[model samples]
Target: MTIFNGYEQSDREQKLNILNLPSLEAEAKKIIPTGGFGYISGGSEDEWTLHENTSAFNHIQIIPRALTNVDQPSTNTKVFGLNLKTPIMMAPAAAQGLAHSRGEKATAEGLAEVGGLMAQSTYSSTSIADTAAAGNGAPQFFQLYMSKDWEFNYSLLDEAVKAGAKGIILTVDATVDGYRESDIINNFQFPIPMANLAKFSEGDGKGKGIMEIYAAAAQKISPDDVRRIVKYTKLPVIVKGIESAEDALLAIGAGAEGIYVSNHGGRQLNGGPASIDVLHDVAKAVNHQVPVIFDSGVRRGSHVFKALASGADLVALARPIIYGLALGGAKGVSSVINHLNDELKIDMQLAGTKTIEDVKKAKILRK
Candidate 1:
């Protein structure tokens, strides 16, 4: 059982009391340093896509059904043979240590307590084995950022699988960093050691910074690489950073078990459509061949409900989750997951739905 197995949340929120995502960010801002906050919160260039990612939800109205059996509304779903008590999961945001001293271990602990799941990043401050242990048997997936050295990936994948990783999420969008003006204006770098990366880095790693590491990444990746990684790991591979129907189809053909729809939380491009705006079309393209996961601009239970209706198997968020970590350590992340799940349950009841399937069949009109 989790440390807060029966602890009341009202009493627990003393560290990070929050009403919504915005409030969560505000509360966390009171604690996290200036540079760290900007790195996590700010988007690329002008961040138009960043603003649009959330604002797009306002235009998509949920057509609530009435007079249905909604008494036993359930927010449970399964991904990669693991049960997600709630449909919302954590996106693989790197460098979580900057937000809290405990970093990914704290996140794993928090999610473990609440029956939630997460995908740990290649740049995580905590290693796969340690994070998995902190999870206390929670099913965890690992996200990969392929390096120039295939040997590094080979060792990393071996470590992750041996550590009991449930699946692999390959992020393909960010070969290089987005032009986040905030990081430049503040001249910030992650002060904490990226535990998973240092061992893989060459020649002491001091000369090879995170930016340099990304710069040296294999940029000419193709569908062939997906097939290669899947063959190597012998585990389910979800090709992340897919923004178009074509890429989704290619990934599916290349043996991707899942298709992740994301724009790197609008931290990649300045002028791209909101992830939600294109989710339906991408889902339509996949046509049930594989589970389509979504991230970018998910801040509410209604957003979770809508994404299901739009054809997402699971929804994810990053910045708000990190903020939760910054505020209350393990419990803070637990509260965020529980808070979103609670809203999803209430949404299912009020919208005349009962199960995860019903939510998928929910009527939503994009205005």
Candidate 2:
């Protein structure tokens, strides 16, 4: 498959204005408010895991093959029964309004433009139905946080299914809000009302803050909760927030259709090992029983390559999408996807791989 159509001279000139991923981030920092930037960019206390996530990729080296016939490499693959043009998916992130006015809807549109998949967070500024509609029927997954009220959680699941969500991503790592120093200092509050739960009354006495509701609801999740969620949905259930082989096995045994290995972008757990560092063991434990999806600290095509080589069937992008959105809404988001797709294609050709499967088989050496 043609992962990225070559850019025109005009388009190239426009892209040169934004350039690379770090440049996009630098641009985003200039536009985003201090509180919003802090919330999106900061990890938990000390930020050890945050730094480790990206640095882990540095510990491994890709050994490219020589002189292979890779004149027309394809980046197409199937994951969880969805035909993905590229394995790089837009990771579920909350409160997109903080990044852009259009919020999750803009993200959906951007992902749809490139035939990429999106996982919409429960705390999204756009409702599941609205986000699905915005995608114009592109494949979308619902990222669910199990609520203390089982009825509420089940109702949300039903709403997502009716709205045409292709799968369910049950996030398991956030039982409580992380002690983010930035959020604490800025006293950051979700800028927009959560579209999905806007009509639902806040009679639970959890107050009106989004973070409070998220923390209270997520506290109810357990291993049995994973099994319950799987049974509740006919669509595939992907358990996100898995960080080790042990939890990976537990999630699989609980009937998860897929495993998402993450640390909530290092937004949770101050000093945890990087998600990439745990990916190999998690993949081994799953043993191909289910696909392993990865996120947290993927910033470039090389990071994408390393994640796949480490046994991630597909990788997700998070903070970068927000950065893109901060720079230019849907167009900026599309640019980020296009840039990554183009980079991945070039990396595959350079690495002498011709398909997504070839990427899976590419050699790697630990430094």
Candidate 3:
């Protein structure tokens, strides 16, 4: 059994049989606070979209090829001019400090160790500079939540550029928090300083709900916002939260360098189609004009492979990586990513795919 650092299983690993994402999540749940876990794990309203996110993967089936020289396959890919060892990037999640002392710093170091990228969230407890310092020169992108304040937005972008962010991820779907009942029941409230928001916005949001804080800050985002961010940052801008080809096209028309297909991990728009279900259409619409980064139901190497085959250039997930971070800090984060990549290698070999490109071209049946 492998543990953090990729070798030498500890008793925790052995006891938990922590070999898959599900088991990893189960273990991490025990250690994190009740409300924290609920906030991390729950979805909006009835949680239909959340459940659909993962379950949707089962309907897509891969037909493996036989007798290909499939030895020594690689998972390496390039995004935004950055060479990454794996296409599985970490999706941005907020308030990682609630899970561990080091938070995004630990996450960046671990991902650097594993050769993937981290999309640092605007709400991350760690600042861009500090997170970049911890990454030790790994390529990282900054996820923008387009605040209602223009000065705040410009200042945030300015800081990202100074900190060496390779790209800007403009998240558009969540202008406010979804109606997550779990949070209501738990009375969930953030309890730490948001380092990036210190100058313009700060504190633990002591008396506010997640919804209230988000509502006060998020803008009525528009395509023009995309243009402005691209112009200001002069960095590749990936428009996240796209569910339709039309929206994807709108973003592209407005100067978005990339299109990110997600449903906010089912934390927004509860009745929507699984993010995976809409990917091929959106990717088809993009028509290879830009890279597609996907998330919201990924839990397996086959899921990653399927997303690639379906059209995503890269796959990302937050719940699993953060769960890993909660359980073991940087090494835990490394362990989670390394395990998935190992599974990706095995799945590629079993499917007789020789490279990441082969996975992209491999046959898949949507049942």
lDDT of 2 by residue, 214-255 (tens): 655757566798888878888888999998899888888888
TM-score: which candidate is best? 1
- Model 2, residue 306: distance off in Å is 0.8
Ordered by lDDT, highest first, the candidates read 3, 1, 2
Candidate structures ordered by TM-score, highest first: 1, 3, 2
TM-score of each: 0.94, 0.92, 0.93
- lDDT of each residue in 1-367, candidate 3, tens digit only: 2222221222121111247997877877777777778878889999999999999999899998778877877999887778999999999998887666678998898899899999999888789899999999999999988878788789889989999999999999988778999889988777656778766644543333355458666658889889998888889999999999999999999999999999999998999999999999999999999899999989999899999999999899999888888888888888888888989899899899878988999999998
Residue 42, candidate 1: alpha-carbon lDDT:
93
Residue 5 of candidate 3: its Cα lDDT? 22
Q: Which residues of candidate 2, in runs, are more than 4 Å off?
A: 1-17, 203-207
Clashes of 1: 0
Using lDDT as the yardstick, the better of models 2 and 3 is 3
Candidate 1: stretches off by over 4 Å: 1-15, 202-208
